[model samples]
Target: MNTTTIDKPATTANAPGGPVPVCHVIKGRVVTGTDVEYGPARARFATPALDLDGMVWPRREPGPAFDVPLAEIMDVLVQTGERLTRDPDGLLAEALEFSVLTSPLPRSVLERSYASLGRLFNRRSMEFQVQQELGGADVLDGWREVDGAPSGRRHRTRAFPPRLIHVIAGNAPGVAALSVVRGALTKGVHLLKLPSNDLFTATAILRVLAAVAPGHPVTRSFSAAYWRGGDEKVEGLLFRPQFFDKLVAWGGESTIRGARQYIGPGFELVAFDPKTSISLIGREAFESDAVLADVAERAAADATIMNQQACASSRVQFVEAGVQDVDRYCALLQARLGVERETASACGNPLASDLRDEIDGLRDMQPHYRVWGGYEGRGLVIRSEEPVDFHPDGRVVNVVPVASLDEAVHHANVATQTVGVFPASRKVALRNALAAAGAQRVVALGQAAMFETGISHDGFYPLQRFVRWVNDEG
Candidate 1:
């Protein structure tokens, strides 16, 4: 309810000579102050101080959102989605301009990502997610009878909304929107700790909801702000179960490690652990020239999207091909990596000097290793008998020649989130083996980033972990 001049230059990144005011939305209220803070040195940008006091709800019982009808929340979300698509207030536009300074994504790619936020809020998507993930909306609304009990007693259960603190990732701006939608759909009181890389999208989406339905319980259930990760002063006070029920964290090892220290008996950690994706190319790709070209393009899509920054982007590919065919596929994939797409740019961030040096060292090793492309962001592919020792990034892909696709399974483990397989049909044969090896999702080549609704992420249906199941028996 606090009134601030949102249209003034002082409120946006385009401000004449000051750091932009990154305000916090606390339970349907906006709180802004004069304190200044900067993001990471690599992508530094200034923002106003976080309103820490406004973050936590006072009582232990559920907030107003717990009592709201499921149908009503859906309507408000659908309307909010419509408004987000139109971007009537230009918040999304302003956020995009601000985000480019913090995020590594190109302006065009960021625009496309922000443009897709509206689809997540639609009625059909929401209904399907609830039905598929939690069984149905009825379970969330109230208790439902269970059909069987060994004791011959009838029982009922509800997917009770939990108090969640989401440490959302910023690799792609869509994560902020998705987190907001999921939190609201589960009817939880969510405090989103926005990542420095994407400081605006979550707040922008929350503002859209606030405008669409002022004072609505669904809108009131949400809040978002930023703080340096691992700030003990802030985390020490809020991480207890009395204030929150779960810490839904997404980031690399360091981020997850920081959150792990706070976990205990009452509060749980639902971690989207750090993961890398890979690709498997069967012998079918080399059957014909046309087929090989098509397969290379598909492989490029999985490896180059988001400039290999996304967890789902393929960093390593195991191709069942000879020396000549594997080299040919590498060339085709390198050319396709620099092309523009909805989620990728023509040119991406340059490869790091260390990674470049490693690739340079491989040049002297004869038939054991072959390199194609360069470090200029047009994409780089290194073919070797084994995976590289260093992590691949900046549109760089490590291609390994495997005797068979089955051999690729040995390289997969708990840290592998996705495995993109060529010859779409090959997925059926490899999915079971891949899953046993700890890979959560086996996607068809080119479709690693194109996730379907109601599917599991990082080995589990997230919504199932986000809520508490309570049962009553008679």
Candidate 2:
């Protein structure tokens, strides 16, 4: 393992007039400015929450001086990956454990989530991403002609790294880690705007980087801080075109909307909007009693991803089966949602009261629609003729019975992120139409969250978008 003597500079976590510790990184330095104490908000659904302890966010120039060549960055990442693989109990692992304490996820879920991220760090995986996502690794070399000369002029391009501001969503810890990886792979000077819910993971990861390779280009090129989502003071200073080339945001409507004022000619916004996913189960699932049970189990697996907090988690199911068969499937799914697994359990997050009331109102008004499970929020299943009006989150799913698989396509829109289909063979029949309707991915029923390296995210190759394709003619 390549180890460097870590030089952690002495700095105050608490500012002179601040209450809690304020944490922010300036250049390569991790400084905690406690000039303000933001929140002791709910990281989980219950008590024993976390407080926002950082404040000072400084703006600085970003350009070639801050950029690390891709080759060097890749080497460092490879070394870090080997170290983590050899000793799972290193500082990075300890930091991840601390992050989990502030998260709402159960212990098993956190373990699974962390392991998934760990697998993404190898040299082969990074090399594969460069090859698959952006033609080839040579694209990082300046001005490579991608196509034969047209009309006697050579057309060449470079994937130039941009100065990016990543507005990370706090729903999942993986987002923070992935943002760091993406920033390093692209060799961009990353300024991460931490979400209120997650303040530990990114900072912890930064510390780990500093430890592994002190003052390394990857360390110097990264920064992270927190401010209110729409704070005019912070956004006004940092969002200016002079400071950043791109604002990569991952959040709901308000977060995306808040970034619009800062975007114009010099700056661009690459957004991963809030999306909902569903499952399409064909009638073939009921061909045998055994098959029906197995298919229902797979549907349950998709429905409970991150306890239904993930965009890829199936919130609804459109089953092309009879009412009786669908009901049997729904019952089986409800039971499966509550089962314990090494990474997660079906006994998940609590359902919001408003959603519970809406479910109750529907049950009261429509006698035809049957409901299973209570508002205690472990897991609930509602059988309805059409998709439910509300967003099905918190392990609650709406099983909508359809006459044919074609009808399920209507519910899919530009906002739909993933579609898990049963009888994997049917995916071929429905794939093109779903893509046309704006769905990004289609997976086998139980594999909504099981992603391989190099798959496009939210309908685009994100790494391809992360860098600026600078073109030159010869």
Who wins the lDDT comparison?
1
Residue-level lDDT tens digits of model 1 in 1-474? 122221212233524554545767888877666455465435545545555556777564667699788998999999999999999999899888878866778898899999998998878888888988999999999998998799889999999988999999989888888898899889989999988778889999999999999999888899998777998767877788877899999999999999999999999999999999999999999999999999989998898767777899999999998878899998998889888887789899887888888989998897898888888888888899899899989998899999999998999999999899988898888889999999999988989989866878899988999999999978
Poorest 10 consecutive residues by lDDT, candidate 2: 45-54
List the candidates' TM-scores in order: 0.95, 0.88
Candidate 2: tens digits of C-alpha lDDT, residues 361-465: 777755468888887657899999878777877889999999999999988999999999989999999999998888989998999878666668898888999
Residue 301 CA displacement from its true place in model 2, Å: 1.1
TM-score quality measure for candidate 2? 0.88
Candidate 1 pairs with clashing backbones: none
Error (Å) of candidate 2 at residue 379 is 0.9
What are the lDDT figures for the candidates, one per model?
0.86, 0.74
In candidate 2, the residue pairs with backbone N, CA or C atoms under 3 Å apart (3 or more residues apart, or in different chains) clash, namely: 21-53, 22-32, 22-33, 22-34, 22-54, 22-55, 23-54, 108-343, 337-346
Looking at candidate 1, what is the lDDT of residue 172?
89
The worst-scoring run of ten residues by lDDT in candidate 1 lies at 1-10
